[model samples]
Target: MAKDHIDPVEELRQNTAQPFEQAHAMPPSVYTSDEFLNEELEHIFSKDWFCVGRADALKEPGAYTTCELAGQPVLVIRDRDGELRAMSNVCLHRMSTLLHGNGKTRAIVCPYHAWTYNLDGSLRGAPAMTLNEGFCKDQYQLPQVKCQEWLGWVFITLNADAPDVSDQLAQVEEMIAGYDMTNYTEAFYEEHVWDTNWKVLAENFMESYHLPVCHSGTIGGLSKLEDMICPPGLPAFNYHTILKDEELRIAMAHAKNDRLKGEERRTTYLLAIYPSLLITLTPGYFWYLSLHPKGPGQVLIRFGGGMSNDFADDPDIDQNFADLKALLDDVNVEDRGCTEKVFKGLSSDRAVPGHLSHLERPNYDFAQYLMARINAGRGN
Candidate 1:
């Protein structure tokens, strides 16, 4: 007798139905199935806002970066007027990508055929095209993608009808106003393609439960499980607060910072912005990882970090950032190992889910968010 094949969407519905206390991890197939990943791409990634990186990274005119979103090549650039714009990276003539990576360029010239475009995506010059009788460069322009800057982060979307990201994250703005997140200087940024399901890494970041074990060599000793506070998530995001041990002075407020008071001075916020932005914000520093699925078992990560203005005037600022960057690099190594192992386990036929821990409220909430986004506009 053949066993009935289970539908991934059906499993997702069942997982999301359980109350937080009675919740269990999502089905292993959700992370390992190619069919489910395609569905997510069609729905969530295609229609929702995706963060690329900090706004300040593209501060100068002609600064630009090339990336892929929802399988479309995208170019994010600063125009001659110093304004951020997102456009199709595909050239108008024969479809060659206009840019490769992050750098500054006075104009976009296709490497394949030398088709030139202004920073604003206007067709600037096309060599030898004038020989053709009916060709007009004025008629060609790269299609624009919707872009907005929110709290110092640059987000773009292919869907024009999607809600504004700033309006969607109003609660987060109110909650972290004391920290003035926009003023945090980005000291370093890097891109890494890791071997893991994007969702697996996202869930790993949503909870502190794994820290004491998975991150034992780096940040584990500083994270005490008892100090964590996990609450039910809101629609746009989920977050957990941790009270840092005062011995970790950088996690505590500096003398220059007067906006934070009481526990706010000693608290750290771990924020999971729905779909794929993960942020770790402390009183003195902030770091975030924005993920995009590369395949069924791979993820592209845009990782960056910086310190708050309070530490801007410290005499040892250079040494302090060097030490901080070193620690962050070590943390990334631990996290990559842990998340890749989870993905490997999920690939096995015998893998089954167990009940969620009380501290995994965010993961349960994340399941609900995923189901809601995937099933939306489908009339399910």
Candidate 2:
């Protein structure tokens, strides 16, 4: 619970730095280093809490879903008692995979040895192997991963020793507590495979620098280039800029709606959870994107819970969402194109690590945060 506590939100309120300042960009090699990427998988993605799926996916008592984080396959299931559990999706005997994809299963049966596991991941049966001496189901139970459900999202941690999820995401939780996210639900979920490093995707989500050029069709008309971005100096990982519709802004002005008039409205709040999770919220809905590093040149992006259930029945909701999704598609594709170029260039002899820009203080902070973790791994 203490991890959920945040520092002063309004501290260092003004930043006079320019947007593309040198201090903001991460070093060039972060995109191309297979060694660095593997270290991130171990220290950041593997150990930290990640939102794998929604609790709604496992609505039935025996419902189940399988996911992978940093190449580690995971299984989440709803038991007969209605409790949700997560575990490694590998069979204990010889460590073979158990399930292929997501589905409801009364018990997971390993194709390799025909070992079976209960919904809670306890050893259920190993067939004739149980007849052998010193073979005990209790000792062979599937390794359990720490999992928790909060704000309708299911989060799992690969490291049993990692800090609690709430503590790890405390600043994000505090900033979003006023948004009433409990009323939201997933109306759209899409995953894209990009030929870029996962860090590039995380950088793309942290700032709206390319909104006018890339997302001109959807957000260009409504978002001012200058106002659409937050000034530097806010907490690097938790800053968000809200971009509101002009009509919505005028209506709020006439009605004196306190929530949408000031910083809370007409802004895009871009938050980066160190390593590879990005949370962005708009007036109509919020989008949670998790970037998984598949390899040195491949990244898998999972888009989860992009709509509000409160407006599900509204006639205009679908149209508005369609436009938003279209804009995001354009933005994401544009980013992919650029990142892939960067990925290819990282191997160039000319490409070397560089300093961050002054306006890019947040990016610098994020890079520092990343380096701190990387350094920790070397016992430096």
Worst 10 residues of 1 by lDDT: 371-380
Candidate topping TM-score: 1
RMSD of every prediction: 1.2, 8.1
- For each candidate, give its TM-score against the true structure: 0.98, 0.82
Which lDDT tens digits does candidate 1 get at residues 44-146? 8998899988988999999987789989999999999889999999999989888997999999999988999998999999888878988899988999999
Relative to the true structure, how large is the alpha-carbon lDDT of every model?
Answer: 0.91, 0.66
- Measured on C-alpha atoms, candidate 2 has an lDDT of 0.66
Worst 10 residues of 2 by lDDT: 7-16
